[model samples]
Target: MTPTQIGLVGLVALFVLLALRMPVGLTMMGVGLVGFAALSGWGPALAILGREPFVIASNYELIVIPLFVLMGNFATVSGMSRDLYGAAYAWFGHWRGGLASATITACAGFAALSGSSVAAAVTMGRVALPEMRRYQYDPRLATGCIAAGGTLGILIPPSTGFVLYAILTEESIGRLFLAGVVPGLLLTALFIVAIYLQTRLYPELGPAGAPTPWRDRLRVTGQASSMIGIVVLTIGGIYAGLFTPTEAAGIGAFLAFCLAVARGRLAWSGISSLMLRSIRTTGFVFLILIGAHIFNPFMARTHIPSDLAELLVGLDLPRLAVLGIVLAAYMILGTFLEGFAMLVLTLPIVHPLILALDFDPVWFGVVMVIVLEMGLISPPVGVNVFVVKGIAEDVPMRQIFAGILPFWLAMAVGLLLLIAFPGIALFLPNTMIR
Candidate 1:
């Protein structure tokens, strides 16, 4: 049989395995290994199994993953997320739907430290939901904002999603991180504005809280100021050419550890737990990379990427039209696939197609991450929606999905803006001090 046919069969098997609830990493590794052995021989396929795990494990750029995860754990234990929420609430809590706005703001801040959507959603939800409830805010608005806001974890700096994208595409992690800054902040602002507008139209959906005294505002801001500085020092240092992504992650983790210690927050048992979680998270990311490494080689041997790229270019469609079609398919796939798994599974093909279309990889990285996260909150299987529902158990699943609509729309609007004006993502990366 032809190699392309073999690749197609492998993809079908991939879906069947996934449907059977096999782990994504193992499924790809198994398919890739079998496909490669079939096309080339047992010797080379076994050699790959022996080599790729060490390669992915020892990758220097990837050390950033565990460091950032550890930083997030330390920051969580330090109560920094709560402090950030408190500070935002002190400033914006008086407006209708203000608590929801604060949740978005704080999630953006926490995303820098956590680099994870589930962490952002769960942490911010625990911190913000009770207060929103106390203020009689609409459950839909409360839950929706957290779910949507939490997705910022992937769009903001130190994003695991972006890191995986950069590695897959051989793009610069620093550039991708900077490229995300404008779009991430823009989406955060759009989410806040969407909530306020909704509240303006229906006041009872989110009632205004009493205004905070300036002193209280100053106090909470002081409480969160150190963590904010740590975020700035890490992400900003990268833009200033003073730190590599790995260096920044290391420094951030050290500072988080220091802060946790200073606050007396990390007992010996908690410290051990934190390290174990970081190691597991890092292992999870690395395992997927190893799988993608194996799978990519097998796909390359099949020549499917080159063939598909040629076929698409031959279609003579307008570049944007082709781009739209690609993104549309990604949206459908991402609705069901976990973002990172889907990202790795496709970039072997999509990156070449994107490069063929003459789109900037850095800008496309930013746009792609946004689209991936949108699917996370979109209907039928909104992962983030379910995450929020998990936190707010009293709220119906349908209500949580309904709540996500505006924030999801806000994300769509933000995606469109980034698409129309690519510089929104590219400007920071393009003009980096280095």
Candidate 2:
């Protein structure tokens, strides 16, 4: 059979395996290896299996993934997330829907440190949910804020989503990180507005907490300062060309470790467990990267990307129209597929079309990460929803989903604004000190 036909069959088989609950990394590797062997030979296929893992594992750029992840893990144990939530609560907790606004604010702050939606959601849920419950906030608004706000983890600077996208597209990680700054802040503001409007429309949804005294607000703000400081030093240092993304990550990790130790939270046993979790997360991400490496070459050999790129260009559609179509596909796939899975699967095809359409890679990375964040809260496979549900066991799963709708629409508005003003994503990257 033709290489293209074989590639198509392999793609179909990969999806079937994924549907059967096989791991994404394994499914991609299996399909890629077999497809390559069919089109080339067993020797070349096996050679890839031998070589790609080491190449991906040792990739210097990828070191940022684990370092940032460890920083997040350490930060979690340091009680930084709680401090951030406390600071937000001190400032915003007195407003209508204030706790929910504080949850979004805290999530955005923690997102800078965590680089993980699940971690942000789980961490903030633990810290914020009980407080919201104490104030008798509507369960829907409380759960929704946690789930939706968690998504900021992947859109803010130091984002895992942008990191992976940069690696996949061979773009500058620093540029992509900077590109996300404005859009991330924009979305955070949008979420806050969504909560405010919802509370206004339905007064019972979010009742205000007791107002904080100036001294208490200042104290909590000081408590959370180190976490925010670290984020600026790491992400800002990259933009200033003071450090590479990897070095920034290392520095962030070291600072988080020091903070945790200083806080007396880094017990020997806890440190060991945190390290192991970091290692596992690092390993999982590396496996997906390796699998994508294998699958990418196989797809290249099949000319699938080229064929699709040519087809899109030939259609002569408006550039924005083509871009919209690609994003829509991502949205649809995100409902069922995990973000990383969608990234590795679609980027090979989508990146080429993006370049062909003359879109900025960094801008597209921001846009893509936003869409992935939506998937994290989108129904059916909404990973963030489940994470929040795990925390609020008394709250039904459907309520969490329903709660997210307003925030989900908020995200959609954010996406449109980013598209309408691409500079929102590009401004920081373009004006980088470097």
Candidate 3:
């Protein structure tokens, strides 16, 4: 069979396995192993498999994944999320729809520490949903805010998705982390605006509650000093060249652990639990990385990516038009695929095309992240939505979806702004790196 036919068949098998609810890492590995054997015989396939694992496992940069995951686990177990929510609530809770806004803000702050969307959604759901419900905020709006806002995890610094993208594309982890800052803040701002407008347009949706005193608000902010310190030590250390990305992860993990222990939240049992969870997640991610390494070389040998790039360039489409089409494809893929899964599946094809087009990789990375962010809020298989639902089973799923609608629109606006001004993503990376 032609290599094209083999690649196509492998992809079909992948989707079939995914539909059967097979773990993503297993599906990719299964199809990739078989495809490699078919194309180059079992002996060569085994040789590739033998070497691939060590090659992937030994990379210095990959160390950041487990460290960052450990940091997030420690932060969650330490109860920093609750403090973040309280501070945001104190500052914003008096305004109409202020509770919902606080939820989004809290999610953003929590995202700084826990860079997984599911983690952010579930944690914020438990912390903020009860408060929103207590204040008679619309259940849909309250739950929806947590679900959509949680997606900030991937766009914010320390994000696993950003880390994975940097690894795959051979981009600087520090620069990629820097690239996300503006876009992440812009999306967060957009979410806040959406919440404000929603409540203003229909004040009945989010009733105003008693306002916190200025002194109390200041006190709440002061209590959040630890979080500020963590952010400074972790992100600031990287940008200032005080630490490599791996070292930054180590600093983050150590600091989170120390903070948790200082707060009396890190018992031996809790530490054991956090370690177990981080190991499980790290194992899964590493397995998927191994599978992609096996599959990517085979795909490159097939010339499919090159062929696609040639076809695209030959079409003579405007560069912006081509970019639009790619963004649309990511939006559609986001609905059904996990963010990491989508990245692994498409980057082989998309990255080559993007490089051939001479577009800025940093800008492209930010665009991809924003589009995936939309997927986190999309319907049917939106992972963040499911996370919130898991935490607040009493809230109807329809209302959760409805509540995210405006935020989704705001994300769309943010996407357009980034596309029009790639400078937003590039400015920090260029200015700081130089």
Candidate 4:
């Protein structure tokens, strides 16, 4: 069979495995290993397996992944999320849909510290969901806000997704992290606006809660200073070249631990649990990385990415049309695939195709992230939505999905903004790095 045909068959098998609910890492590795052995002799495939593990593990850039994950886990156990949400609620509690807006704000802030969407969603769901429910906030809005807002964890700095994208595409991790800032903030703003607009159009959707006393609000603000300090020290330190991304992560983890202890939130038992969870999460991530190392080279051997690039260029389609097609594919795959799976599966092919077309890599990364963010909230297997659903199980799944529609629309708007003004993504990275 032609290499193209072989690649197609491999992809179909991969999808079939995924349909059977196999782990994504295993699916990619399984398909790639079998296909590589079929394409080349068994010797070359065996040789790849022998060498690739060391290569993947030795990659200096990859260290950032576990460091960031560890930092997030540390922040979660430290009880920082509660203080951040309290501050947000105090400031915004009086406005209609204020609790929902506050939830988004708090999620964004917590994301700055946590950088894992699942962590952010699960953490904030614990902190914010009950409060909103207590205030009789709209179930749809309350749950949707947490789900949608948690996505910011990936787009904002310290993002595990950004780190993976950087390592895969060979882009500078620092610049990609910086590029995400404006887009992340814009999406956060868009989410906030959507919440307000929803409440305005249907006041019944979010009844105003009791106003927070000014004195109490000031006190909450004081409690949030630790979070502010950590954000500045970590993100600011990275941007200013005071520390590498990994160093910043380590510093953030240390500070979070200290703060947790200072606040008396962490017991010896809690520390042990946090360490175990972080190690387990890190192990899962490393396994996926190893799988990607094995899988990516096999796809490369097929010449599929180059062929697709040539085919697209030969068609003479408008750049926008090609981009639309790519984005549409992400949306579909995202319904069933997790973000990391989507990136690993596609980047091996897509990155080369995108580079061949002469699109800016940084801009393309931002666009890809936005598309993946949509997948996080998209139905059937939206991870963030499920995280929220798990939190608010009393609320029907359909209602939560319904609540997410406007936020999805807001995300569409954010995507358009990035597409129209690539500078929104490029400007910060260019100014900071160059």
lDDT of each: 0.92, 0.92, 0.86, 0.87
Candidate 1 ranges beyond 4 A from true positions: none
TM-score of 3: 0.98
lDDT of 4 by residue, 1-434 (tens): 98778888998898788889898777877788888998997899989888877887888777777777777776776777888888988988889999998999999998888778888899999999889888888899989999999999889988888887887888888888888889999999999999999999999888887789999999998888888898889887777888888888888888887877887878887877778888887777777777887888788888998888889878999988988899999999899888888988899988977887788998898889889989999989999999988899899999999999999999999999999999999987787733
Q: Which segments of model 4 are wrong by more than 4 Å?
A: none
lDDT of 4: 0.87
lDDT of 1 at 171: 97
After superposition of all CA atoms, the RMSD between model 4 and the true structure is 1.4
Error of 3 at 317 (Å): 0.2
- Between prediction 1 and prediction 3, the one with superior TM-score is 1
Flag regions of model 3 displaced more than 4 Å.
none
lDDT measured at residue 120 in model 2 versus the true structure, 0 to 100: 93
Write the number of the candidate with greater TM-score, choosing between 1 and 4: 1
- The candidate 4 region of ten consecutive residues with least summed lDDT is 70-79
Alpha-carbon lDDT of model 2:
0.92
Cα lDDT of model 3 by residue, 272-361, tens digit: 778999999899889888888887877776678888989998899999888888989998988888888888888998998899889999
TM-score of model number 2: 0.99
